[model samples]
Target: MTMQLLLTLLLAVARVKASTLLASHYSGQLYTLSLSSTNQLSISGSISSGNRMPAWLDLDSASRTLYIPDEVQWGQPLLKSFTVGTDGAVVPKEQIQTSGGDLHSTLYGGPNGKGYIALAQYDASAISTYPLPLTGAGQPLQKLTFTMPQPGPVPSRQNKPHPHSVFTDPSGQNLLSADLGADLIRVFRVGTNGTLAECSPAKSGAGDGPRHGAFWTRGNSTLLFTVNELSNSITAWSVLYQPGGCISLLKRQTTSTFPPGKSAPPGSKAAEVRVKDNFVYATNRFDRSFGAQEDSIATFSIHAASGNVTFVETTSAHSFFPRTFSINAAGTLVAIGGQTSANVAIVERNVTTGRLGRLLASLKVGNPGAANQEDGLSAVVWNE
Candidate 1:
């Protein structure tokens, strides 16, 4: 069994089937990057405080660890941690806070079996739970804190409790949030120690500011899409998985990450809404980039008996403002990111006919405030 131990176990299964797509460019700080197959690419940045802003990132592949939600300045507002070493990269380590402040990180699946790192705390409309720490580094365990519900906008838009995005509900036991100034779509109950109770009120979309969302779990009738940046549109809903399940609003289209006549700004938004396998990607943050965040990945395609979303391909034309994207694991590759496209737009996923080719790499992340102010990029995937 020794030919150099079979070529180091065949290059460790060819770098785990050759996967490593990473992106996170959240503005002032947090701009990480990667892409592999021995292309061996690397880019990193870090800086914290000021606004702890590391925006969002999640990757828990059974504790390989990499979860972030830091937006802390004078303390209290973090859930940061990283450690994917062994050449798979990613290293930072610990940060943990979350008495609830500028939070917004995602990935939950731990009623106790392990894998929890959710947080969408707009100063406490709340949704924080940190348990992705299996003695890999420790220091996280803030556990329960769910309170969010003040929706029903209009008083100049309900003023506050804007818990942006924190989804999950395919009978994962519910925990869907998307409250841009509380326009609505909140439903929690996945407790065991990592808590969050409230329930119901899962529908609202007119000026539909409902931040990010996605879930089409192959269908049996479990669709759910939400990305209403103040009403640009993309609603969908229809999740009724009982245990106390029930979620309506089955349709709401109207998309435009900017490219059809264009025109968006004045508070600028529609940040993200990814869903892989059946295909679904969104991110429309024009906020003034000449009629669209310079065209940043709107591509859609899903109707497996009504999950609605048809518009296959637009990729911000050539890129610049995605702030997030993910869909790999042989589904090919789609890793994008945003905030002026700090860079990482791989595309290239023809896997048969899911369509999307060329531009196989756009890696250029390095300016999280010039070295690593935690670097601002918001989520990119493929660590699994």
Candidate 2:
């Protein structure tokens, strides 16, 4: 190979080896940042969609593309796509209008080797599927609509079916959705053609608003845990595969996300949950009025054999309303984004001790919106 060709090959390998964190803001901007070998964070580049605030973000490493839902509360909703350049800059590729529904979450995965993006709409009470080259956006291939069969205990928040998050099972045979308004974890069988077949919906306690979940296998069992927004608790379930390839989620344990003898302050709600080996971490959103009292990330220690989790300790997120966080691919750094604080908090993770070190740095991300506005941070994603 020529000297220039060899140099290009080495550079490509180095870029792929570095870890990246993608932060989605509610101000219609998406920022790409990277963690260096010594754990320093630097802004790479960003892309914005005008005033169409981008909410949830999912990245396909193989395609080097990012997917987001245009959650314009006062305008039309859309699905936007972007290509991640070699320098970690995002370039707008395509966008498709989703009519009137407001999309809240999106996940990219499928069972039969077919790529797909699963979409959830909280306002429309629907789950839809879009086939992916993800090169260009267009209409969804199929949509499954739902209604609230019965009202949840919290009338104000659960009067309708509000699907908050959607993800495919690690087994690749089932698609699971956490419905916040209906208090149910809906499950669907993944078909070869990317269609969904109705399966048993995992029922939760009446006031337990299921928002997001994490799945992992331990021993001979597959485990799933969800963060409850309304009740401020965590629910653990054992995923069992039945005959003819069906699935069931049996409750294993339920525990408060708060520390022992401690109660969550008023207006505090759980936001996201993530697991890394023996340690699991989750974030909470609180009214900015509560200030430092309610802004925290609760940590839990998981029992390797039982699939049960114990509240470890609560760490101050160093900012307000930590809506989302991500652990880097090397599992050495944790990046947290504060929605109300409009900043990103970075903490070092001691993998050997399973304890997070003190705050190392914070990055201001977007324009600070009014108290009632959500124009701050929304999601944080990490990939190598």
Which prediction has the highest lDDT against the true structure?
2
Tens digit per residue, CA lDDT, model 2, 1-384 = 987677556535543555677888787788888766555677777767543777777777767777787666466677877887655777887666664344554454454344777887777788888787544446777788898767789988999998888887777778889999999999988777778888989998888999998987777778898999998888988999987666899988878778888777678888889888787788877733335533788888888877788888877776777888888655667888888777788887766556777887777787655443567787777754
Task: Quote model 2's TM-score.
Answer: 0.89
Count of clashes, each model: 27, 0
TM-score of 1: 0.31
Q: Give the CA lDDT, 0 to 100, for residue 278 in model 2.
A: 82
User: What is the alpha-carbon RMSD of candidate 1 to the true structure?
Assistant: 20.3
Model 1: per-residue Cα lDDT over 90-124, one tens digit each: 66776645554545666666653446667777655
